[model samples]
Structures are given as structure tokens and as C-alpha cells.
Target: AILNSCEYGEGWATDTYEKALKDDAEYLTTEQQAMIKAQHALLKADHDKVKSMHDTLAEIA
Candidate 1:
């Protein structure tokens, strides 16, 4: 609750960064939205690869 209620002072993480950090955002900063989407895609790909490897190892075991 403290983080959510924090005031936006500057672009610094210790300030407004908490509020800037949101979820399921369709438009984040407008400029960084595309980059954020790309980052999410990379995360999903990495997660899928890890999951697949785990499943394969489980089957082997």
C-alpha cells in the first residue's frame, strides 16, 4: 500500500519508479512500450525453454 500510494517525484526508481512499475500495461512510457514488449517476449521464450528442458528431464527420470 505504501508503494502504491507513494508520490511521483522524479524519474528515479527510488521515487516514481514504483508507480511506473505496473502490470498488464498496454502503453508504458509510449517510447519504451515496444522495448518492454520485446523484453517480455524474451522472458516468455526463456521460460518456455526452461520448462521444456525440465519436462524432458522429468520424462527421462
Candidate 2:
């Protein structure tokens, strides 16, 4: 069977760059840092909208 050929017998292997380095450090790499920055920006914008909505609802209540 295919599982017989695998070293881990069908289990996952850490042959990929990301998987190999994932545990080396929690620190983000350059590309990951950029993506994180973009995510932060979007979250900040969403948070501002939520705050505005709450304020408006409070005023109406």
C-alpha cells in the first residue's frame, strides 16, 4: 500500500520550509511580517467601525 512506502507510515512529514521553521521561533519572517501588518490595518479599521456603530446605537437608545 501507499502507506508502506512512507517513512512515517502515512503520517505527515516536515519536509516543507514553513513547517520546518514553524517551531524554530514564533517570530515572523519578512513576508509574514508584511501580511501581519496588513491584517492589523484591517482589524483597526473594523474596530473603528464597530466603535462608531456602538456610539450611534447608544445615542439612539
Candidate 3:
């Protein structure tokens, strides 16, 4: 269940990021892509950690 939730969150983030990029494609540059990539990675990692914590709590209970 935790894994599923994490995957869903990641997918949502990816879709949102892609949409934003498409919306601003005319103004986005290579540097912007790099910045977005970094931000995306950070978000993904944070989501994963939160999911993991939930899983651990469920295991304890």
C-alpha cells in the first residue's frame, strides 16, 4: 500500500511538471530543465520518505 501511494504521488508530480513545462515551453531553456529536474528529485525523495514512515508506523501497530 505504501509503495502504491508513493508511485501514485510520483506519477502525479511528473504529470504536473510536464504540464508546466509544456505551458512554458516557449520560455523554458536547458538551465530551466536542470532546475526542474533537481526540484522534482527532491519532491520525489520527500514523498518516498513520508510513505516509508507511514509504512513503518503501520507495521508497529
Q: Best candidate per TM-score, number?
A: 3
User: What is the per-residue lDDT of model 3 for residues 1-61, given as tens digits with 9 covering 90 to 100?
Assistant: 7666876787689677777666876688989977887787787787677777777877998
On the 0 to 100 scale, the lDDT of residue 34 in model 2 is 63
Full-model lDDT for every candidate: 0.47, 0.48, 0.77
**Which ranges in model 1 have alpha carbons more than 4 Å from their true place?**
1-27
- Residues 23-48 of candidate 2 have per-residue lDDT tens digits of 54367677875665565556555555
- Model 2 scores worst on lDDT over the 10 consecutive residues at 7-16
Which is the better candidate, 2 or 3, if ranked by TM-score? 3
Residue pairs that clash (backbone atoms under 3 angstroms), model 3 = none
In order of TM-score, best first, we have 3, 1, 2
The C-alpha stretches of model 2 lying farther than 4 A from their native spots are 1-26
Reference-based TM-score of each model: 0.54, 0.54, 0.60
Error of 2 at 22 (Å): 18
Q: After aligning candidate 2 to the native by TM-score, how far in Å is the CA of 16 from where it should be? A: 26
